[model samples]
Target chain A: MRINPKTLEEVAFKLLEKAATSLPDDVKKALKSAYEREDSPTAKTELKNILDNIESAEKLKKPLCQDTGMISFYVRSREIENFVEVRKALIDATVKATETIPLRPNAVHPITRKNTGNNVGEHIPHIEWIYTDQDHVELIASIKGGGSENMSALAMITPGLGVKGVKKFIVDTVVKAGAQPCPPTIVGVGLGGTVEISFKLAKLALLRPLGSRNKDKDISRLEDELFNLINQTGVGPMGLGGKTTCLDVKIEYAHCHTATLPVAVYFQCWADRRASAKISLDGSFEFIV
Target chain B: MVEYRLKTPLKEDEVRKLNVGDILYITGTIFSARDQAHRRILEYAEKGLELPFNLDGAVIFHVGPIMQRKDDRWVVVSAGPTTSTRMNSTTPKLLERFRVRVIIGKGGMSFEVAEALKRFGAVYCHFTGGAGVLAAKNIKEVEGVEWIDLGMPEAVWKLKVEDFGPVTVTIDSKGRSLYETVKKSVEENLKKIYQQI
Candidate 1:
């Protein structure tokens, strides 16, 4: 089955708009509960401000944060004939969204630091593909701001150190990142892969909805353990000090070489902006979040 | 923990009175300068060149707002704090060169910046990170802009704002820092967690 490139472009543009302007429901619910349970007046104020900011952005149809963020599209399809066309359409959508949604032109040259004006540049609007037997095309758009992105970490640990080392690294990263990534953050942990794969998995793990556990019971238990350990730090909202530091911790893992253990951690700030859509071969699409 | 409504071109006396954790709602003019702009400011000062805008007693917001041109004027769609820690190296010098009374951003700054705040009679404030729309709503006007060649985000935007906060003082002129206090406790907590896990 084939879908029109124009339809894909429009869908991609709307996804960018939706991702930028609205905080996902799962994130909102987590934040609301964080606010309810928080004890520190300062932490509560920060959370309240965030809640108010979300409301204003939705009401006014404005981008949620000034850092509209680097865009990434995760596409999953079983059989699609227009892979090249799909890529082009997504880029075109990004260029259009930069002006209409008025994203902050975040993409820049690494060396010279020249702004691209539109959010597109070399290797930008990074598209990741997954092939599945699904009947419909699944596209997930995630926008992550620089502050949180800067906090991402990759650690190569001794194999003998095991899960305890992984847990230590995760907590250390969060405490080190205190207040910068805009807590209460949602942490994504990627474990037991090659260096790059671990980092990629960590970022990909962020696409999962808050409160969703991994299918693997061991990993799910590990997620719960880290979540509690992080919150116990009292790093709190905006890291000024309070009870809740992390709203949720999501983990994704792959089997590693017998000699190596690589762990990567990624943080999504409180905004946690993302949206998903399922596009049918008939050219119809529905936003899932 | 006090709340004060301040107006810029703020006096040193007023800034010195602020304590860590005090909330401020500021009025009048402020300028937005990120990493690049901060570099340029120091460069210009070193070259003995005059700046396009005044920095004396100014509020420097570490933001790169999403701006749009409607007719002839620039409108701010969203303006939020960028991480201030990135500016730590240059900030002490900026404060030393000018009477920059309030430094507003997120993630706080280093002990060096806190020391500079103490020395220069200024305070570092945090405008809740990622609260862009809220920040823009309080910004009344884009009074002017400079260094457009530096690109939209890096350009020096002279903003007119009113009640432009709920910004909290995280590092005060007295050398007390809310971030430092929190960091100590987090470290202590980290030690405990390490022992358990």
Candidate 2:
């Protein structure tokens, strides 16, 4: 059984590029819904413009924005009896994809603050392994851009803050962010962990479908409440005033310290970039691309 | 909010007409320079070198564009507004040195830049941040690059643009700011709504 690391990378590279130009189906549906419910004239106009932009991007093969974001992927690979060239393949794939897909070289020198000439860097384009052993490698590719990435938040408040305080903090963060995150955003909220874990979990929560309801009854109830409160801020589509400030409010939680209430909020823009693939140990592969 | 359609070599009277929140679709040639290139341009101006683009009444968009491959040519990727606060320190220097009239970017501008825009008869125009694809359509063409070696993202892209839709004058010549208005209003509203019943 053998897997072509070169092919895997090319697929990943092309997937990232496609995701930039093509809005995910879930995200598209959410925006269309947001446009229908948006009350502010200005916000509505912005929403329509965004939809139009999406259409043009698909038709003309132009990126949804000029700043096609930095590409990041999450991989879950399994060890089989064969395959020695996995690591080399991955690196070669990155460089190959960098040329083929031509991802904007986003990785920079940590100190000099200069681009690394390639998107690949020490910790960049991180490939987090999900630890699935099914005789194959499965990768989830996400092209996280800058604007929404800049809006990420984490709080290690006292236990006294509780869920209500958590709600208040999340609202403040998004409201203050205003139009900065690109309105009708998909918010990923992670609760109860160490500060770093909370931040990571919060970002992971963004992978959920746009309007899917949380299975946890208690968390789902909170999700509804926060979603309503956020939209009430009237920071519509582009912060020009609107009812649908966010397309969805996603929450994730883990066990925490006795005195700590760690919280994080990660915002995903309307672009909502993501794609995935599965490569079998038998050289067969499938990708969202 | 004031709306005007004027050509280059813009005068003080033209500058005086724009008010905060006024949406202007400016036409003409503008030089696009982001962080790295801005640093180089300022360094060049210090050494008394002529700028790549004519400075008088010129607009400088603070953007670093992404490149896409299109049949032997590299095109712009999603080039949207970056945080403009990063430019606060460099911008006044650029405005004073280069005589730049209009600045386009996202987020808030610095006090010094705002003050300079007013004093020097310039205006700080803000396009809707994150709407790069929409903004690109208004760009008629990429005239050329000054420093091609700077790579695709950091290069100083000269763009000929027309009616780039829906850019607001967040900072006007008379010294007004839409951010200030919104922030003040939000603050005032925050106090009223959150006050203990």
Candidate 3:
């Protein structure tokens, strides 16, 4: 089974557009719950309006939010060559779409003071490739909204604090960040790995199924404790106070330096707007509905 | 509840009578600016340009929104509010330099901004963040774009608006902020809820 470049570009571009306009079921579920649970007549009304906007945007094939974050893709490839060509074609496509599709441009170098106008920058589609035994590719795209991205936190504590420390950090950060990151978020907690690695792991954790487990028993149990403790924050739907503060807490961990215990907590708004696709060696791809 | 629609060049006495939670469907003229413009305003204060508009009874909205195609011009798409905290460091300077009477945005302001609001007889209003579309309905026209070079979502957009509904007073004229109240309550609730479990 061999994948071709043409199919990859075709599949990738379409997935990007669909992800922008359509709200996944998990996201809709979380949003609906938030709308129903919101208590402030003002905030509640606002949430309801947001929901209506989401539905209409999807129906009209328009962007859900004007901020349409910088597009980032994570691809798992196998025996793939011409990777450079693949990147060029995608960048061209992204730029073209910036005008044709008219996606808002959000990518700018921190200091250079340059705007890509197209979301693609120097290392634009920023791809992280994973190696697997088979001849297939699993690619996922997630939009990193600035508000929530700014709320991500990492703390290196003594190994002694363990789950207790993790719980406290998660709750404290969310409470302090109330409504800032857009609450009732899907939390991605990365444990173990080095500082940067752990932060990356947490961001990657967001790609997993909303309520799915890590498959490792210890990690799974820790996720449950953190999830329960987080929702208990009662930061509520929009921080107006409600039973559901977090839709789910996904944990991704890696072994770390013996003396170092690093952890990262990343939050994705209820939009949780992301989509994944599987490309078989035969050059066929299917989006995870 | 008090409501008034006045132009720029506001008077302090008119500003003093306004209270928190009072619904103001502000008409007349208001200037829009976000990160870049705020930074420039600070620079303007140091060099001292006559300033763009009268600030006494005027409202300043912190926004950088989507540009949509109108019949012949660009329009605001969900041109709703952005986070106000990011501008906290500049609000006091903005108020004192310009004598701004109203600061409209989402999220709350810092203590310094609150003090400035009280001292200046101004108030902070929290318009919905994602309600750009609904907020645009209040805006009758774009007026024109100020800094086109800043690019979308960063450029300073001047808009003439009508009755934009649903913008509530989160931070008030008397120096009390609803965001702070709710945030403080959230902290207490978290301590109580997590302390036991």
Q: What is the TM-score of each candidate against the true structure?
A: 0.99, 0.89, 0.90
Task: Tell me the whole-model lDDT of each prediction, alpha carbons only.
Answer: 0.92, 0.73, 0.72
Candidate 3 residue runs with Cα over 4 Å from true position: A1-3, A40-43, A133-136, A279-285, B1-30, B50-56, B68-72, B137-140
Tens-place lDDT per residue, model 2, A83-156, is: 44544555565566566545567677767766776777786666665656567777677777677878778877
Please give the C-alpha DockQ score of model 3: 0.43
In candidate 2 chain B, where is summed lDDT lowest over 10 consecutive residues? B188-197
Worst 10 residues of 3 chain B by lDDT: B128-137
Ranking by TM-score: 1, 3, 2
In terms of lDDT, the poorest run of 10 residues in model 3 chain A is A234-243
Span of 10 residues, lowest total lDDT, candidate 1 chain B: B187-196
Tens-digit lDDT track of model 1 for A1-289: 5658998899999999999999889999999988999887888898999999999999999998999999999888886788899999999999999999989999999999999999899999999888899889888888899999999899999999998888999999999899989888999989988998898888878998999999999999999999999999999998889998999999999999999999999999988989999998889999998
As a TM-score, model 1 comes out at 0.99
- The two-chain DockQ for each candidate, comma-separated, is 0.91, 0.45, 0.43
User: Candidate 3 lDDT, tens digit per residue, A1-289?
Assistant: 2456677777777777777677788778767876676666655755776677677667766666666677777777765577777666566656665664456788888896556677887777677767677667887777766777778888997888876776788778878777666667789989988998998899888988777899999999878887887776666655555666788899999999888788899888765678778888677788884
Selected candidate, larger lDDT, 1 vs 3: 1
On DockQ, the leading prediction is: 1
- Clash list (residue pairs), candidate 2: A65-B78, A65-B79, A66-B77, A66-B78, A66-B79, A67-B78, A67-B79
